[model samples]
Target chain A: MSAALRLHRADTQPPADLAGEFLARLDRRLHLPQPHRRQVLDELACHLDERVRDLMVTGVTEEQATRRAVEELGDPMVLARRFERAHVAPRRRRIMNMLMVGLASAAALTGAMTLRAPQVTIRSAVYPPPDAVQQVPQKPLDVQGLPPDVQWGDFFSLAASTSGKSPVVHWGALRELDSDNFGPGHSLGIDPLVDQKLTLDQFLELINTEKGFVADNRIEYREEEGRLVFATTHYFDRRETRLVTYDVSELLRARLGGDADNPDRVPGAVHEIADLIRALVESGMWDVNGGSASITTYGTKLFVRVPQRLLPRIEWVLEQAADAHIGAHQGASVDRRQGDPLHTPRDGAALPPAAGSSTVVSVQLQRVDPAAARQILNQAFDGVPSLKQCSVARWITVDASSRTVSVSATQRHAEFVGRLLTMLDRPGADVVASAESSMQVIPLARVSSETMDSLIRAIAGGSTLYGREFRLVANPQQNSVIVEGPTGVVTALQELIALLDTDWEEPAKVGAAIGR
Target chain B: MLHKDAQRDQAELVILSLLDAQGPLYGYAISKEVSGRSDGQLRLTPGVLYPLLKELESEGLISGSVEEVHSDRKEAAPDAAEGRKRKWYRLTARGRKRLAARIEAHRTWRRVIDLFIARDPMDHDQKEHGR
Candidate 1:
């Protein structure tokens, strides 16, 4: 018996009543083996006893301490459920194991099928000679005298008989191509058979389009010892899926600004860019729209897989979009600064009267305390001439409880206030105090070091202190980028890398909430 | 109040690191140590603490041993005969390895988050004006 038990024995109204009742409830709910249940109850009882004893030492009465200890342990039913989940949930484990086994078996089967070669049959066919063969002694067989299918059969049979090498027919490929519905009229219409002495390559080329038995550019052939092997390149073959990764971080950085005001803004921007690319490019070429192409993003880079021919088009669209996005920002900034009527605030705020347009905007602080943020905003607004003219102090309101600030001022002054609030509400503002240079090696999991190096350079180049205050070296062998700079910049770079190094696969939802 | 899910995620690493630093400790001592170290911000209730300990023990990351502790109230009460049981848990070799990996992961996560919240140094003028 512990001191707690002795205390319980001395008092008629024992504090142990609360703990004992809680344990009993827990014991009833636990579905564990007897020994395990006993062990758990014993451990929890010991913890409760210690807590009650410690509280009693602080001058609290036995009953109060016991009740407090029991309450702190939480509801006995919840604890019992957690215990059961930890020790008795074998059914969930069994289901997960079954799923793993099923997936492994499926993957293994797919691998085996992919590795297996298609079977080819070597055979020769001879077609009966056409009637009235106006045998021009040195000339090739005249296809104009017979039906197209028969003419092809006659030429093929003759070529197979004389070539010494048996023709290896890919029956599976032939059936597939035939099922494509390429009817009789889709022939190459070239007369390679016009000359009697044609090379093997010339003969193969002619047969490549014979009544479309095999479509042009889809057939590949080579002489294999005593046989000629022919294979058809299926359009849906895995080999046809070309993976191209594009570094679009620079373009995004330019459009969204070097430091985005909203944390969600980066993802939103990425989504918008991806959507634009998908919409501008041919719809029939993407996997999302039932095409063979697929687009995925990891961090700031776009990973696109389409036919080799579609690569040029995708690149062109991204380039055009980047140019348009950057140019729009520049043009909009200039127009806004000059108080051009055409570039008025989208909120329908009235244009400025000689000085500047005035608008009322409410900004909710995400990271900073609203009370402190308002005090700071008040002082900053007093210095701006345009804001002062609009009587900024009278128009600004801060609601600390809701963490929001509303301000009415000239367009430029209002925009400045919003930008200031964003800067103040940064996540780790305290950690940026150290300006000492430090070297950090960031190991990239998805993007290559060379590619990351170029992106880092692009970002660093935008800074005024690039070569002097900051420097970076990419180690391709290690697949890591070594950045030497002030702790703040390095920290920012790491955050940027983490942001850009994600696997974003859903093309439809990428940046879907842009203007909203 | 911290979110329950977030608290649970941090609890594992905190427990592992505590055990590694302070050696073997029983349940109550572990709870007190955590609360004391974090200035009472992290109070590991029995519900969250016990299940995690049991799970860790089941996974062989930590090992628990039961000890019979005799009461000092023998002279005060004749009916108190059976000694109470106190289970002490210690970090296993596997737990130490897990702790190292978890610490690295945590540091990387912190660095990323810190950077996300850090203000641009180029905007020093704005900060000064606000001040």
Candidate 2:
């Protein structure tokens, strides 16, 4: 037989002496007559013995069989009670059963009452108090106390009214009355909504609306030069007559820094000049606040608007800016291709430096429209696709009608443009030649001599950037890394250096001045 | 063996049915016969079955007689020389009627249990419609 079956057979085995012991226990518990007790014992003994015999047939030991047989009969006390129930007087049985029923019902009632009772809960702490309200007046506090000599209220009143000389005069006289009265916290921000990209006319209109100036610009095509010349006049409050005329043509030619014989050189130069004009004007425009004038460049001229009293200061600032441009142009290395006979200047030797230190210089800009300027720029870029690798393109823009260009790029881009423009002046130089000639020495700034040496070693030995081929000369004496390669590669190194040092200054800032 | 209470109520029926089927049987023989018929699932001991037998005899559902018989054991057997007297029981007319009634009640009970145990087609239809 299987192990489980054998175990089951053993489990069902009757106990050997269980029946005899059970009957004795029952007999002691039972209240029966003598003859009846004798008869019951005899029958029960025979039944138990027979049960054991039957269990033995199922392959259980006699002892186990007898035990199982007696166990099957249930507890002795319980069995004796059952027997008593069957044989006892009916009246007594009824009383016992009634008592059991009464006890059960009482327990059930107690449980139901316990479940129906209301539950008790512990509450949380009270809510927090509200915050204090600020005691502020709805309208602004009136201007009360004032110095006898200065009329700050009079100046603001004039400012809130007509855009005329009275307001400008009062504001300036007040400042002159007490220079330090407003304290160091009196700085003002006069930012117009110039966040969106705008054309020169739109920008001028916005300035006129916001700052209350009258700006008028005109582009005239000259048959003699076969190109257009742009000029703009600015009047203060639409009343002042003595306007400043900013001639961008000379500035543009100076920025281009080469002979204009090479067709490629003229367009690139025009683009750069327009960019430089736009940059200078935009900088002057946005940075204008107290005692500052608003200026903008379109085509070949910069228009300025300022109060009569502040006109001298504005002109002085403009002269200084012009001088800076002249200095950078004169400092630029002469284009070696100037001697190339085929690429001789068509309009005489009118190079950037030849413009002289005149207060105002004018020349023919480009005859092309804004679309043509973009096409030229795109053409220029097609020859030098690597320009797209860096973010320098966003800083330089071109306008064909005004033939104006603007550049607000980093110092690196400026240097690259300088080199590219110089190369483009060559007779046979295309965009590629100009692009390749973008090689220039980039000075490292704010780097310790030790760090500079290590970086130079890392770059030269090809270890710092994996798989990058770098050609760099480390000048410990100057504390600069002079790099000569494609503009993109040079820019990558610049970015890497920037990543390494947050305080690192642009090498272009430390190199040749802005105009150059 | 069933629970004591259930055994107390059904023991008389079991004995009557046994006697009706096997004819007259002594106490030990009846017990052995019960165990055998149930494949040893039910066993009645002296303490339980004896009282039930006496109750049945008093109720007139069964009648008992004292029988003197010779032992069928071999001469070498331990109790062969000793003759024993045993009380034999047989189902009376009233006992037979009671047994038949109880068996019918059991069949009715089985049918009632089937109502819950078996899957009703109406229940399946109601569930499908509800879904």
**Interface RMSD (Å), every candidate:** 9.8, 26.0
The TM-score of candidate 1 is: 0.34
Q: Candidate 2 — which residues are off by over 4 angstroms? A: A1-26, A52-78, A89-516, B1-11, B40-47, B69-82, B110-117, B120-131
Q: lDDT by residue for model 2 over A1-516, one digit each (tens)?
A: 111112122333334234545666666655567776666655555556556667878998777776777777766555555555556533332222222222233333343122232121211111122114422112221223222232433323322232221222223322332355322234211222223344323433443343222222221111112211122232222223234554544444444546534454444443333323323332232222222445454444455443333344434433433334333233233233433222212333232231112111111233334344344334443433222233234334443444433433343343334333322222221222333312223333334333544544432344232223344544433334444344455455554443322222222322223333
Least accurate 10 contiguous residues by lDDT in model 2 chain B: B71-80
DockQ of each: 0.15, 0.08
Off by over 4 Å in 1: A1-12, A88-516, B1-4, B73-80, B120-131
Name the candidate that leads on TM-score: 1
* CAPRI-style quality class for the chain A–B interface of candidate 2: incorrect
Best by DockQ: 1
lDDT by residue (A1-516, candidate 1, tens digit) is 233322222344566656776777777667688888888988987777788888889999878988899898886756776776667443333223222222233333343123333232112111221124222122333344444334323443344445555666554564565554332233323333443355545555545533323232365544456665555655323344566677666666556665444455565566555655565555444675566777787666667776554556666656665555343432113223422112222342332222233556556777767777676555433432222333344545676766666665544445444544554465555445665544456655434455566554543443322124555555543445666466676666665554333222221122122110
Fraction of reference contacts reproduced per prediction? 0.38, 0.22
